[model samples]
Target: MKYISGIIAILLLSVFAACEDETKTCDSTLLSDLGMNFKKDTLQGFLVKDTIWPKVTLYAIGNDSVLINRQPRSSAFMPLDPLHDTCRFYLQLDSIAIPDTLTFRYKRVPSFVSPGCGFATFFSLDTVITTYNTIDSIHINNREVNSSNDTHISLYFIY
Candidate 1:
């Protein structure tokens, strides 16, 4: 009976130890992501904002995974390289034969949120360079990108 009681106590202690909370997870929403919005110039002397791309494919230059596949998209959220000072992306529109290259120059600022949330990299856009193909020009809507639902870059399509 003494041995059985000792075994039961050990099992209970093991169970309690396993139940301790030591899991730390970083929130996905806190990632440093850049938002891009698309717009087109209307012949009616006004810019039509949030213009959708009927067939668009976008991906980072070095990355194999595609961010925006061949689908209709009006906006896109892409993560910047935390270790690099610049990031490049390939944007291909359906109507355009040559894909446009977008290069973004930025400064990565590492910010500490909390103990559980380690660190987040924020970006300050210095400048943007793009090859004119389907895109006529680019505008920096917001210079600061801090994982918000705000448009950081506005891409104007050639009308």
Candidate 2:
């Protein structure tokens, strides 16, 4: 009888241990919270502001869909000094898939321009729509142009 009782106690302890191990609390702030329903994969987007001088707007699109509406964001803009000729912007994404085509639209705000340029140019621009698959990375650059200097918008994505 003693031996039987000991075995029963051991079995009960083992059952309790197993139950404790099986209980797990799910994290509420997971990728699912972001609306990404992939069971075995995750998608994320990040924006990298390279500079704060010029102060332009940045937008992002994925699979020809506006992931980030053309919202204005600070961009690298400096006084039209002889030294500065080009403007740079950056955005980052991880574990994302690019659709067949993506479109980027940007408008530069003239308010950020210095007195060097006679009149601000708001050059509405769009990229040569192209498709992307398994895009591991991406970057966008708006070269110097003499056009309307309104808040500029651009699109970049990765898969």
Candidate 3:
């Protein structure tokens, strides 16, 4: 009975230790690789309001075709290629709206976190350009797209 109880206690301790170790992964990994805020410039930037369209879709501009569709969102935290200097996205407002391409130009810097946390990539926003179809303009509101959790870009849609 004593041996069994000792074994059980050790097993429990191991289980708890495993759970604690798993938490060592940095929370910065969950940070948005690129944060986007969709807004409508009421009176051409005098008053800006977050606009969530009912049928907006986002797709990665590559062969892998990562897609986020039919999501009504005012803001989004989308991932970008850590190794690539540029990230492009195809965005559509609705089924009938023309697909507009937004291209992000930036440089990725690898952050050396603790050994347990490993490393992460942070991007510095250089320029943002969008096709003037449904999108009116794109602005890099914040130049540093890092774990600071700030909106990196503001996208204005034609109102």
| Best-performing candidate as measured by lDDT | 1
User: TM-score of each candidate?
Assistant: 0.76, 0.19, 0.76
Clash totals in order:
0, 27, 0
Which order, best to worst by TM-score?
Answer: 1, 3, 2
* Model 1 lDDT-worst window of ten: 20-29
Please report the candidate that would top TM-score against the real structure.
Answer: 1
Q: Where is model 2 more than 4 Å wrong at Cα?
A: 1-114, 126-128, 136-159
Rank candidates, lDDT, best first. 1, 3, 2
Better of 1 and 2 by lDDT: 1
The predictions' CA RMSDs to the true structure, in order, are: 8.4, 22.0, 6.4
Query: Per-residue CA lDDT of candidate 2, range 60-85, in tens?
Result: 32123223333333232212212222
Residue pairs with colliding backbones in model 3 are none
- The lDDT of each candidate is 0.83, 0.32, 0.78
lDDT measured at residue 146 in model 2 versus the true structure, 0 to 100: 36
Give the per-residue lDDT of model 1 (tens digit) for 1-159: 769999999999999888755446544457678899888877643747568888889899999999888888888888888889999999987745478999999999998755567678999999899999778878898989886668998888766
| 1 versus 3: better TM-score goes to | 1
Error of 3 at 70 (Å): 1.3
